[model samples]
Target chain A: MKLFRMLRRHIRDAFKSVFRNFSLSVASITCITITLIIVGLSIIASLNLKNFTTEIEEDVTMIVFLDADTTEEQISTLTVEINSIPNVEEVKFKSKNTSKNEMMQESDFFKETMSTWGEGDNPLKDSFQVKVKDIEKIADTAEEIRDMDKVSVVNYGEEMVNNLISAFSMIQKVAIIMVVALIVVTIFLIINTIKLTIFSRKREISIMRLVGASNVSIKIPFLIEGLILGFIGSIIPIVVIIYGYTALYNHLGGVVYSNLITLIQPEPFVYIASLIILGIGMLVGMVGSAGAVRKYLKV
Target chain B: MDLIRINNVKKQYKNGVTAINNLNLSIKKGDFVFIIGGSGSGKSTLIKMLYREEKPTLGEIIVGGVNVAKLRNRKVYVLRRKLGIVFQDYRLLPKQNVYENVAFALEIIGAKKEEIRRKTLKAIEMVGLKSKIHNYPDQLSGGEQQRVAIARAIVNNPKLLICDEPTGNLDPERSKEIMDILEAINKEMGTTIIMATHDKDIVNRMKKRVVALKDGRLVKDVEKGGYCSEAI
Candidate 1:
């Protein structure tokens, strides 16, 4: 019961100090809010970029064309050879007939041009549809398959996919670096501001110590004050993340330019992001306040 | 019984000035003692050491059975809680009113609300500042502020009270009022007091136990004596 009363008093004192030093508290809150907003934006961008990269990775497939006169036994041998290559995930044979039929279904131009050809006179080449376990090593797997005898051509839109992957990876790295740096700056900013706030009250703290207040009792109020500042600071940024992200997603039609580069769904994503912002705000506030009190207050 | 025992205590500052050197003294329980000395005489340093503010370079100081000379900073609060301290400057929180200021000491030690209110009021009444309980520190005169400081010190019912120039900032009339309160607390409640001061007239008039210091050494100690110029 006595411990509970002490906690209550500490909380009350913290609240009173927050208002008593209104300008200093506001400065700290503003710093937290601004940094959290940028951090939130960076997090959202990085996560969405990651989603786009994964979607594109899943869609990448290597198509290997075979010699036109390959025998059934030779085709079976070729399938086994391709499967044995490192990183080869799955292989499916597409007969020239199936390719021709797929082309016909795609447009009337292919249908008109190919309908006159008989089964023996078909000029289309058979191909193997291949997938790899690791997209990073897809080029090596494709090179191995292309060097095999009787292989005509291997194409997986290599240049475009590689370029896109490199670009997205760079952006993701920069976003993460930005988020981490901003949090660090916020921590230092809070420490300095809280130091100023407590400097004026150093005498009060000494008097408290002289009157026999324990170190923990002296620290509790400042810590709680930091928590309150952090809590208030996070509210605006959280609102921005929830509302701004959903609005942007809606404005861009849930995708940036194409279906492959899409935004995360708003339901759980924004809520989770808001929770992260709140957590960061409170944690940073507490840490910064603790640092200030420990270094400056002496008690 | 001796409530405080100082044996071969020595305090040398980092700058190489020895504030106290190989000094020993003892005070009994419920004794009202005066530590009389002039400037740079090591009286303040001695009082500061008693509160563990300035640790002794060597030796042991046993206060209320606790060895304060070697006590750690983290545990200093335990020793301070058993004692009341008053300063010449009257270190009251400017923002806190007289009642809150007095009640703060009890609140820090986790005293119950009812006990705090009763004891805080009683301490203030003892200092004759019951009428100024609602006024802030800035609103009160120096004597009233010192009374508030006194009330805060005694609120926890500390067995030992240490005063360092408690009447230094006040006029003769105000100083007399403070001395009267101190005497009443000592006689009525039997609280041991060790006060450091330079007020020769007050010291001479009180006729209490006087311990004099000069150049970091104890020059004289006498029971029921006046402030002596020969000792210096």
Candidate 2:
């Protein structure tokens, strides 16, 4: 019961002090707010970038072109050989006629030119569309298929795809490192901000100690003040995340530049991201206050 | 009947200055004792040791039956709860009013709301600051601020009241007013009072038990005496 009363008083004192030292409190809150907003935006961008990369990775398919004179039996054997590879996920054969028809449908120019070619004089090659279960081993799988009989060429945009994947991975790594560094910087900034607040009230704290306040009792109010500041600081960032992300998603039509680079749907994604921002803000705020108070307690 | 017993206490600063060296003193309950000394004569160090503010370098200090010299820093607040301390600067929270300032002592120690109200008002009234209970420290005179400090000190009803030059900042008239409140608390509640001061006039006028220190040694102890300039 006595503990409950003390906690109540600590909370009251924290709120009173936050307002009593309004400028200092504002400085702390502003510091948290600005840092958390950057953090939130970075998280949103990194996750969306990851989503886009994964989508593109899944869409990658290797095309194996066969010789125009290859027999149906040889094609069947080649399909079997390709499917036996450990990385080969799926294989589908496309006849020359079907390929020609697809090209015709893609454009009026192809339709106009292709209609003049007789069936016997057609020059399109039959091919197998291949998908691999593991993107990392796609090169090995492509090599194995190329050595097969009657195979003329194998193409999956190897260099461009490899470069794209590696570049995306590097970007993701840099994004994560940037976010971590920002959080670390925020913690230090918040600690110094709260230290200033405590320094201003050194006289008040000395009086409290002389009056017999325990270390825990003396620290409780400052900790609560940090928590309150962090909570308030996170509010604007949360608002920005929930509304800003959805608006950006809507304005961009859920994709950036093309369908391969898509944004994450904002339904639960925004909510989850908002929660993360809130957690970071509160945790950093409390840690900063605790650090400042610990230093003062030592003195 | 001894409320505080210092057995050969010694305090040496980190700079190699021995503030109190092999000093012994004791005060009975309800006694008004004055510790008089020149600057740097170990009077402040001796009083600070009583509340566990400055741990003695060598010796035992027992206040209210607890040995404060060996008390841990984590448990210092426990020892302090049994004593009240007033400083030369009054040390009242500048933002708090007289009533809140007095109540703050009890509030921090987790006293109940009703009990805090009763005791805080009683302590404030005892210091004769009932009319200025709502006044802030800046709004009050130097004497009134010192009275509030006294009220805060005694609000917890500590067994010992320690004052380190409580009236050093006040004029003669205001110093007398502050002294009157301290005297009332000592007589009415039987709280042992230990005060360190440089004011020879107040020391001589009070005619209380005077303990004089010189160069970290207790030089003179009198039953009812005036301030002495040196060892006698």
Candidate 3:
């Protein structure tokens, strides 16, 4: 019962101080909200970037045109050999007839021009479409398969794939640096704001200390004040993240750049992002106030 | 047994300023003792040492059987819990009213709600500020504010009351009134009172036990002494 009463008093004092220094509280909340908004936007951008990169990686397929003089038995043996590669996930055979039929269905000119050509006269090459498990190892796997006999030429957009991988890696690095810098700045701002709040009431704290108030009693209220500030600060950013992300998703209609890039759906992504922002806000507030209060608690 | 025993206590500040040097003193329980010294004579340092605010550099200060110099940081608050210290500035929370100010002492120690209310009112009444219970510190006179401070200091009914120039800011009349409240608390409750002061008139008039200091050393101690030996 005594412990409960003490907790109640600490909470009461925390809230009282929060309003007692209203301007400082608002400034702290604003700092946290702005920092969290930046953090939230970065998270959303990074998540979508990760999704887009994965889609590009999955679409990377190596097409291996068979040698024109290779027999059907040799072609089948080559397909089995290609599937045996460690990094190769799937190998699908596309016969010349099947390729011609797909082209005729896809284009009106192919349909008009290919209707007079019989299967015996088809100019299309029989190829094997090879998908790799790891996009980073795709180049090595394609090289290995290209050296195999009966393989005429292999194309997996080698230069374009290399550029995309390097660009994505660079974006990841920049995003990480940005997130860390923002968090550090947020912590510094919170510490200064809380230091000011504690400075304003330093007299009261000294009096309490002289009266035999324990260190825990002196610090708990300030910790609670920080927590309340953090909680309030997170609310605005959470709302903004949800509303902004959903609106962006709707405005872009899921895909960008002729269906080449896609945004993550708002279902679990927004919820997770909101949770992360709230967590960061609370953590920064707690840590900042704790650091500020430690210096004045020498009594 | 002595309520407080200081054995060859030495206090040197970080800047090499010796606040108190080779000081030895003892006070019995329920004794109202005056610590009389001029400016920079270590009167404040002695009173602060009694409450464990500033530890002696070289000796042991045993208060109520506890060696304060050896007490750890976490246990310092426990020692302070048994001591009620009043300052010259009347360190009452400016925003808190008389009742709240007195009650704050009990609140910090986690006293029960009913116990806090009863004792707070009793302390306020003892200081003759029951009428000003709801008035804030800024709204009260200097004397009244000091009374509220006294009330807050004694709300927990500590075994020892240390006052460092409690009436330094008040006029002679107001200082006497505050002194009267301290005397009443000492006589009625047997709470040991160690007061540091520079007021010669009150020290001469009260005729209490007086300990005098000069150059951080105890120059004189007399039973029923005045502010100075010549005055006695």
Candidate 4:
């Protein structure tokens, strides 16, 4: 019975106080919204960047130009041997003639050069192209391919592959750092806003206590107020993220088309993931208000 | 039968002042007792001791057969339910209207909604503030506020009604009116009334039992009391 009375009064007091201090409450809500938005956007950006890096890693393949003196049996043997290496997904064979033909199709200028080469003494030779099972192990696969027999030369832009891998790792590191930093800011802002709301209701709080209001009843109203503000705040950022994402996508449509290698770039999932991050912001506000009121009530 | 028994209760302040000392008394259920003293004669301290708001330095107090001096801190809420306390300042919540303030006592104790409403209305009528039921504490005059405070005190139908200078804030006519209401409550309800006041006017007219203190000691206990104008 006492619990019911306290719960009812707590509801009434929280609503009255929240309405009574509208401007300060709004200030708290806006701050929470902005915090959630930034955190959310960053989360979405990080997740998409991760997926992009994985796609790029899967695409990386190494082409081995065979020795000029290698025979058909040796070439076949080499293909079998190369395929046996750890992390090798598949080995594709391209004959010397097929390589020249592919080069010729690239341009009319390359066709002339291709036709000038003598038939018997064609410098192009059959080679094996190695696709790695996992992109992360591309460097190790390349190193093992270097020591294989009948393999004259291995060609894959080692520097480019290394730079791409490093860039992906850096993106992940930076994203984690950004997430940690934003969470701290969100908590601080949310806590301060809750504190202000609590301050406004100090008088009402005293009356409740003097009237023998239970601690739970006194806390529930403030807790609800905080959650409402935080929930409202979380929405603002999601909208901003959606607006900014659509605008960016519209204006950068050409860039996305031209640059197929977007491994380090954030995609649409980044935006959705950012909205989830806003949920965390809401949680921070909720817990913060509850904590502050618990301290203040001390009953 | 004895409803309250106090034995040698003492309270010494930090400034080396003895507020209450070796206080011994016994009160019955129908007793209307006034604890009186000069300004620094420990009257207020003695009243506070009854509520356990201030514990005694020595001895014991039992109210309604419960050992109040040894009462657990959290259990004070239980003790307070049977006890209705009124302060000199009225201590009426400023934001609440008379009816709400009166109902507040029931709300804390979780009374039934209809019962709370019915009883609050009755209390308001008893204090003759039914017309001002919706008025806030500040809107009413000093006397009205005190009456509201009294209405709040009696609304719970507590066993013991302790008034610590409840009429101290009112004028002579207003004071008389408050005393008359208290006297009527005493006659009708059989509640134990323990009032602490330095007021000489209301003390004389009540013609009830009076206990006087001088410099932390019980100096006089009178059957028919009057103002201590000569002592002052």
Q: If you score just chain A, what TM-score does every candidate get?
A: 0.85, 0.85, 0.91, 0.80
Residue B94, candidate 2: Cα error in Å is 2.6
Top DockQ hit? 2
Residue lDDT tens for model 4, A26-94? 888778877777777666566556666677777887999878888899888888888888789989999
lDDT of 3 at A221: 86
TM-scores of all predicted structures: 0.90, 0.92, 0.94, 0.77
Question: How well is each residue in B190-232 modelled by candidate 3, as lDDT tens digits?
Answer: 8999999988899889899999998798988999998774322
Per-candidate clashes, comma-separated: 0, 0, 0, 2
Ranking the candidates on DockQ from highest down gives: 2, 3, 1, 4
A189-252 per-residue lDDT for model 1 (tens digits): 7667667777777788888888888888988888999899989999999999999999999999
Expressed as tens digits, the lDDT of each residue in A256-298 for candidate 2 is 9887789999999999999998888888778778777776663
Order by lDDT, highest first = 1, 2, 3, 4
Across all models, the iRMS values in order are 1.5, 1.4, 1.3, 3.6
Q: Give the lowest summed-lDDT range of ten residues in model 2 chain A.
A: A290-299
Per-candidate DockQ values are 0.62, 0.72, 0.70, 0.32
Model 4 misplaced stretches (Cα beyond 4 Å):
A1-13, A21-24, A37-102, A115-138, A144-168, A254-278, B1-26, B36-76, B89-96, B168-170, B208-232
Candidate closest to the true structure, highest TM-score:
3
- Pull out the clashing pairs in model 1: none
Identify the superior model by TM-score, candidate 3 or candidate 4.
Answer: 3
lDDT of 4 by residue, B4-107 (tens): 89998888888878988898999888789998888888888888878766778888998887788897655555666677778888878765789988998887
Worst 10 residues of 4 chain B by lDDT: B223-232
What alpha-carbon RMSD in Å does predicted model 1 have with respect to the real structure? 3.0
